[model samples]
Target: MNISYQLTQGQIGMLISMPHNGQLIPDDIASTMTEKAKLVPDTDWYMDKLYDFAQAMGIATIIPKYSRYVIDLNRDISGVNLYPGANSTELCPTTAFDLSPLYLDGKSPNEAEIQRRIKNYWQPYHQAIADTLADMRQQYERVVLLDAHSILSHVPRFFAGKLPDFNFGNADGQSCSQALIDKVSALDLSPYSSVVNGRFKGGYITRAYGQPEQGIHAIQLELSQYTYMDEPSDQYNQQKAEQVKVKLQQFVTCLADFANAKS
Candidate 1:
């Protein structure tokens, strides 16, 4: 199946990527997942809507259609753990963060099947990202990539306690330019202080393609579900979401201004 990409009318060519917002499950894969997994509660619910402002600002975007459970596009295809000591999902997760089995009994994909899934799903998503960056590089002198993500504020399975409202990851400043990071940090995002290379740093997409010297900058914004959604469930809360959107708009707008001024 072909991957999907959404582009805005921006001459600036900044790319906003929502790699984990997808909720689609292929027919074959859907057959193997349990009812709980099919609900896709772990998804970055409504992230596309969260970043809808980007379209108006003429920023292009790339969003995957299939769910991350099918194949995590943010993960390292080489199978290296994004978090070494901490628990994490694999290239094709067999269990959910809650430690519940995602696949039906005896229906999990084997090694060969996993390889096939990667070839079919994982590769294309990254390819779209790569192609977008290449195009942006050609069109503009500098390109900014923002990888969007959301997760439950409290996942005891992964971390010790509740997470902050905003988690900004740049692979410890290795992913993007200091200017970009400084610009993002300057926002009055108080009570939402960001961690540079904390528990959840930049993922595969942020680490692999972010070349500051090459004029391509990437940063991952991992928002706590409480910032927008109702945690532990996938329900949408308009009032709370709007409040959060104001802060996020400031965050992205800073990046846009920085990119425009720098470029």
Candidate 2:
């Protein structure tokens, strides 16, 4: 119902998407949620802050204004599981990352409510992605989407042990080009761990939008929260963020160079 998101146009063919960066829950929606849900602890906290370099680098970006609790923008419109046979949340999630109930008894959104959210929240966000990518494809020989996110180092519901600092997912090489993958994998991410096509093999955004044949590449970077923030306090650590930003800058530069390369 409200302004769904913010869009920043860029001089280059790179678009950084932070679908889970938001933490705001409408007062009306907040009233129906449990105390833990109101906290919005599952958010991809401070993603915009961490990726501030994108602006100067002439990269475009789209940021959501509502929490994923309102509706997961990165998910499919049909509510299909992004990861089947695995414990996962819903498009209109009823539970948090810890598998705890988000809504109070009898407050969970039913089918009708879910439809409304899809129409209002989900549709608009995805439309922006589609339109922006389409425009990029028109102006450039290649365009790359960096779907950015951050999570706590450990979430038992999804994985057993601590997550790597940088988790790159390209839907098992179906999403982006092998060249871009090689570029990122070659980065010197010292003092941090990284994996490709591992636990996170890209989400809906990467899977749906990435079309290497069409010259539009998409990849997801699921960062470990401990790399840039104080997990216990949910606060930004400037020193820590600066260090991670260096690597992120390298990744972006590679993506930009890839996009600008002659086809």
Candidate 3:
């Protein structure tokens, strides 16, 4: 099946992505998932709306339509786990963060099916991202890739306590220029203090695609769902979301400006 991508062409300074916000499940796979998995609770719900400001600011975005449970587009295709020993979902997650089985009895994808998914869904999503960056680099001297994501404020399996409002990960400074990182850090989000290269020190996409010396910078922003969504329900709160969006706009615009100037 062809993966659908949303692309908004701009001057190509930075390319923003919402890889996990999708909810579309292929019919074949959907039939196998339990009711709980069908809810797609672990999705980065409403991330596309959260970053809608990108289009307004002339920043391009590439978002997938299928859910991460189908195939985690952000993961390494070689089957290597992003978190190593730490708890993490697979290419096609069999269970949720709460350890609930996603698939019904005897319906999970086997090795052959998994390989088929990798060829069909996983590879194309990443190729699109790589292509966008390549195009951006050709047009501009420097490009920044902002991988947008969100999670529940507290996932005990991953962290000890509630997470900070904004968790910026740049693969321990290997993904981007120091200036780009500093620009994001300078935002006056004092009320919601952020952590740079913390628990989520970027994902496979951020680490693999980022090449500072090559002038293709990448960073992952993991926002706590509480900052914008009503947890458990996954409802969007306009008032609370607007407050956060304003800061995000500022953060993204700064990166755009920095890229424009540097380019």
* Pairs with steric clashes in candidate 2: none
Worst 10 residues of 2 by lDDT: 1-10
Clashes of each: 0, 0, 0
> What is the model-wide C-alpha lDDT for candidate 2?
0.92
Write the residue-wise lDDT of candidate 3 on 150-192 in tens digits.
9999898788899999999999899988888998888898678
Query: What do the candidate models score in CA lDDT, each in turn?
Result: 0.84, 0.92, 0.87
TM-score winner between candidates 2 and 3: 2
What's the ranking of the predictions by TM-score, best on top? 2, 3, 1
Q: Write the per-residue lDDT of candidate 1 for residues 99-197, one digit (tens) a residue.
A: 999999999999999999888877777777788789878877788899999989889988888887888988999989998898777678765656666
| TM-score comparison, 1 vs 3, better candidate | 3
The true-versus-predicted C-alpha distance at residue 89 of model 2, in Å, is 0.4
The C-alpha stretches of model 2 lying farther than 4 A from their native spots are: none
After the best TM-score superposition of candidate 2, give how far the Cα of residue 136 lies from its true spot, in angstroms: 0.9
Displacement of the residue 200 alpha carbon in candidate 3, Å: 0.6
The candidate, 1 or 3, that scores higher on lDDT is 3
Per-residue lDDT for 1-263 in model 2, tens only?
33989999999898999999988888888999999999898999999998898999899999999999999988887878888899988999999988889999999998998999899888888899999999999999999999999899989999988999999999999999998899899989888999999889999999999999999999999999999998856889999999999988888898899998997
